[model samples]
Target: MICFFLFTGCEQVSKSIKDTFQPKVDTIAVEKQQIPDPVPYDAAVERQIEDAQRLVETVLEKHTKAHVQYIEGKNTDFLTNEKKLNRAEEALKKLPQYLGKEIFIYSSIHFYNEGKIRVMLQHPQNPEYIDNYVYENETWSDPEQLSVKDNIRSRLISLQKISFTNVAKAASVYNEKIKQIEGAEPITGIYISVWDNNLRWSPASINGSRERYSIELNQNGTLKKFERE
Candidate 1:
């Protein structure tokens, strides 16, 4: 040990000071925890969701009887590594309560955008009626089961994939979106949808009589879209 003293002798230093320069080695073997892959995010999903909301506004203007049930998609917030699925589970669970009895509900809107949008209100007791009125833009197709085409059959197949969806990591990602809107109000209705391998949902407050913000995410928790409806 080297020491510089103004006057005099060698004295004993504290044990903590000595340990600071010399660390003790451990003999135990420890296992490291494996981490999961990080979730992905894209601003495009948010934009698309927003666009869907705008369309809902136009749709409501012409048809006063219609309402935006819910909007769903997959998107992520890189900062928190969150799926940004905001209030998804809450909205999803609200749907079953809306369609209590088994009844085939018709589709009034079709998404011209990249992703698909399907609506269903069925005999709350049966699954067969869910595909009855499901259709594409301006063209109504019968429900079929196979092939990955854009027909109602493929849509049914997509809906069946929701069995693999998980919302254990859900959080509030719509707060900012709601605040960003011009005239958002208290939310009244929520809609849930199963699209292929994605689980879409939203926490929406009505902007007057229309929805202000909603978000969607894939089954893997990747955010697909965020918009107003």
Candidate 2:
């Protein structure tokens, strides 16, 4: 009877151990099954993202450092501060567009001028759309919309010289003018384009119901004309 009780007790303990360990084995198997395959990394896509991140960081650093300089009394020019603020705001506007977007280099064209290149980029998951970006003197301009037939490389080479800030200023002026018009919403984005020897600025409101307005800037960045459409 003693041996019988001892054997029964041992059997119960063994069963308990098995019961405790069985679930763990099952859980490990399930976890192994749930493991996902590694995603393939694309070097071109990675390079594009890194470039955009670097651009954002560079702009932010410029803004922050300018303020730091002012606070430390290294510079006292109020106009400079104002200009910096405007540039910073412009740069900040671009930040949201790049967030959560996949960017890839679509194409690149070298200009006759040394150190100048027109780079086309595909971004925002829209395979049909491409953007034109100008790179010169180690600086990159904000992207402009590029259509398949734009021939941006030749256009850039022939277009009259104009500062990007001038284009931005013209857009800002139009934005303010639109705000005073009845039923017009705030301008959320402005795209610059050169066609037919004319510089065009299109500012559209974030509100879907509002229509985009077009403004023409002269070669010198003067507001030549504007129209609602």
All models, RMSD in angstroms: 16.9, 16.5
lDDT of 1 by residue, 69-167 (tens): 232332222112222222322233345444333233322223211122234333345443433222223233443221111222222323223321233
TM-score of every candidate: 0.25, 0.32
Candidate 2 collision pairs: none
- TM-score, candidate number 1: 0.25
lDDT of 2 by residue, 41-60 (tens): 99776875565455434423
How far residue 167's Cα lies from its native spot in candidate 2, in Å, is 2.9
Each model's lDDT: 0.36, 0.46
lDDT score, residue 11, model 2? 100
Instruction: Name the regions of candidate 1 deviating beyond 4 angstroms.
Output: 1-151, 158-160, 163-171, 180-182, 192-216, 220-229
Q: lDDT of candidate 1? A: 0.36
